[model samples]
Target: MRKNIMNRLPVILPVPAPPPPAHRAEPVLDLAVPVFNEEADLEPSVRRLHAHLRETFPYPFRITVADNASTDATPLIAARLAAELPEVEWIRLAEKGRGRALRAAWSASSAPVVGYLDVDLSTGLTALLPLVAPLLSGHSDLAIGTRLAPGARVVRGPKREAVSRCYNVLLRCTLSVGFSDAQCGFKAVRRDAAARLLPLVRDTGWFFDTELLVIAERAGLRIHEVPVDWVDDPDSRVDLLPTALADLRGIARVGLALARGALPSGRPSRSYAVPVTVMALAHLLLYAALRPAAAAQAVNALSLMACWVLAQPVLGRPPLPAPPALPALAARLAVTAGSLALLRHAAPGAGLRAELAVLAAAHLSLALPVAVARSARGGRRCRTGSAAS
Candidate 1:
């Protein structure tokens, strides 16, 4: 988040380009291939993708080679391809970051559905249609090729695989993200969605992908995931340790931003985090303090009930919500009452430690889902207000 949000805007304005001849159809999908120092792989990958799109893709498509400060022959090759292929174009940037390349090219694309693919082409090109179909049809705000989802066939080394899983798990636990994969290079977004989200995103490096998705999810945009066939690039140049460390820092930054409600969304800020945490500790202490006077189950029930009553006011929504089919007030009462009774009976003979664990688990399980639900619901009211500037 260190980068100025103002620096990220201004790219969305109309970009200069040579006007095509009359009767030349506008591309429905504009795919950006971000590259850096990949002279050898650039040509073949671009050609392969072009050929594949030409042979199989139903609608008109454009392939963009986004050269991000590559010192090698990559720029020359990209230029040649753009001049040779009618559907190919190239964008030059002085900086070196995948996110920079994407933002420059994606922000300038004329196509309604814009996406990016890694220059290595590790993901199967066969999944391209499925990836962008939703965005093209206006069914989803964004789509990503997921390697972790069911039916996804991926071939990669164990170490990278472990790191990928751990990174995603950290997102889930810390950020409450709904999407399965974050770093996958194969992703697409509607032009309007990108217009709204890019201004809010500050990371112009590896963290850009995650920051975009987090903002999208919090804004309650519909994100579509397509299980894909992926193969690891054997000669990939990315250094995992440095990248992983950077990603951790990015997560912490985004988490803090969300807590302060710095983002422009309807989702509640996590200002209650401190007070709520203190409340939990106090509840536990109250139970322990009363242990000498009452049974464990009685103390548990009383402490939990007191906390529930206090939460109504602490949450700032004094009146409970009204559910569509079920009464919100009744549902809340039933759930709270049922959870307490079960907590009382679930560990009747257990020691202090076990009972406390059960109490904490039930509370967490109940709370986490509500937090996630609120995040998702915020998307429906997602706004790209000028407040971000």
Candidate 2:
């Protein structure tokens, strides 16, 4: 019996180990610099930034120079610096633009917080501490040095300053983005914030700066715009007129997006749903009552209902499959039934018309639901994201 039991020994089953618990490592702060043809500027800027980092930062830090397809010694200079400085990381992108290079570099960094400052360092290091402190303290997710921030000084030209003011005003009117200096090249982002932002951003040139800030603001990230001491670099690459024109066009794009109620990051806007629904119902009822057989009227009614169904799903409401037929017909029938019921109590055509008009107006009133939902969603989006827009 013992021999038989030994021979019948069963195979051992290996127990699967549970997954290691995810450790939330403290976020490391990283400094990113965008380089173009500034071989002359790179070394001096690196030295200055190194000095600033040594003097101020107590945490582990890394400096990344994103070489934007430079045709000069920028990459070589960066490599040399990286070799000498353990904290320095050199990133070379084949794309030949400051914005493109910066995006690539920022993406490559594993640090939880990252930011870009101009190679010229027009904004002072003193200002940078305040800008990044909020992020370090966990009070903000992003920081931007604002030249136009209240009480900030510009130790340079008044003409360019005037132009900046006018440009901001134009942006305010068009995009409704509320940044004091959206054009400021000095900006920082928390890793999660950057992850959400960089993908949605498409502009790879100078316009990238504005577009990024716009997207950040809309995403509801807490962006602290620190007032900074700014001095214009004598060798600035920006062409004011052309840059402004491009930014204006960007603002126009922003306006168009807003009109369609498209936000940069998050779930679709639910505010337009009820208004769209009301518009659809109104069109159908109006067509049936006035021009029932008109081709244009039928088309308009059908189009409105179709738009409503499409919008309803986006607005967090159930969608009707046959919107043009079922939803539209239902609205029309409701109006017709009401109008007929009222017609029996008064004048032939007058009472019916009045009843239809009142009903249409009541249907149009559903816009309030959309407005409230949009406002609440916008507020939530802001609290969770960045103070960018």
TM per candidate: 0.67, 0.62
> What lDDT is reached at residue 342 by model 2?
62
What tens-digit string does per-residue lDDT give for candidate 2 at 1-389? 63454233332111112332366333387788888878899999988998888789777677888777666766667777887766677776666766787777778778878988999999888877777778878888778888887778787788888988877865554455668788777888888888888887777877887888777777777778888889999778888877765665565455445435565544333233423443444344445445444543344445445544554443443232223446554665465445445654565555334544654554544444544666687688888787554
Query: What's the CA error at residue 51 for candidate 2, in Å?
Result: 1.3
| Cα deviation of 365, candidate 1, in Å | 15
The global Cα lDDT (0 to 1) of model 1 is 0.77
Q: Any runs in candidate 1 off by more than 4 Å, and if so which?
A: 1-21, 266-389
Superposition TM-score, candidate 2 onto the true structure: 0.62
True lDDT of residue 92, candidate 2: 69
Top-TM-score candidate index: 1
Looking at model 1, report the run of 10 residues with the lowest lDDT sum: 317-326
lDDT of candidate 1 over 85-184, digit per residue (tens): 8888988787799888899988888899999999999999999999998998899999999999999999999999999998898677667788999999
Best-fitting candidate, scored by lDDT:
1
